[model samples]
Target: MASIAEVKAQIEQAKQSSQQAMRAVQMLNNQLDQAIQQITAASQGTQHPKVQQSLVALQQAKQKASEVQASIAGGVRSATEYAAQL
Candidate 1:
């Protein structure tokens, strides 16, 4: 069995990992947003390939970002609570 100190350390590590993952997701989402904005601005009402790709990226990111954030939050919360109880 792990000691309380070890468990607390692991919890901290898990929290850090979650934070890193959240930052990565945020960065990717920001990129997607920028791509969409730029594509939309320069599209000029044409069926441009870049605009289509950006729209798909925006859709995919919208679908996944919420799930990613919620999972990160839940994991971090669970780790912290478990450590606190130790």
Candidate 2:
């Protein structure tokens, strides 16, 4: 049987994990925004095939990162809820 202190520790850990996941999501969003700005500037000023390809890659990366972040957030929420119940 786990002690109350152990349960409280677990809850705190869950909260920290959730906060870290949120921070990671924010970082990914920032990167996506920067990538979009780069793409827009490149399109407006000069046309380079390599730059266009990079932009596409960056967009795809952003999409994937978003999905991962969502999944992580969901897991964190679920874990936190479960820990609270304990």
Candidate 3:
């Protein structure tokens, strides 16, 4: 029921939001990477199971964030394509 212009505007808004989300996710991942590095450095020459687990957990979280960011980028691309067709 909406006009093409309105739909295009909505799509643009969604794309922008997706971009922002992607940036946020990327920032979080960077922080996670830094944390992982710090933990590794602090635990050098030590064999702590809990520290190992923490590193694994942080790595997994970073991976998941990367996946989420990729998904958001895909959505933004799709929205841009759809808007172009309008």
Q: Highest TM-score among the candidates is held by which one?
A: 3
1-86 in candidate 1: lDDT tens per residue?
99889889988988998999999988887877887787788886889786787788787886799789889999898888888888
Per-residue lDDT of candidate 2, residues 7-64 (tens digit): 8797778779777877887798898889789777868877888778888888888888
Error of 1 at 30 (Å): 0.5
In model 1, pairs of residues that clash are none
lDDT of 3 by residue, 16-85 (tens): 8888888889889889989999999999998899999999999999989988988888888888888888
Model 1 score (lDDT) = 0.85
What lDDT would each prediction earn against the true structure? 0.85, 0.81, 0.90
Candidate 1 weakest lDDT stretch, 10 residues: 48-57
Off by over 4 Å in 2: 45-47
Question: Estimated TM-score per prediction?
Answer: 0.82, 0.74, 0.94
Arrange candidates by TM-score, descending: 3, 1, 2
Better of 1 and 2 by TM-score: 1
Full-model lDDT, candidate 3: 0.90
lDDT of 1 at 46: 88
Query: How many residue-pair clashes does candidate 3 contain?
Result: 0
Candidate 3 global TM-score: 0.94
lDDT value, candidate 2, whole model: 0.81
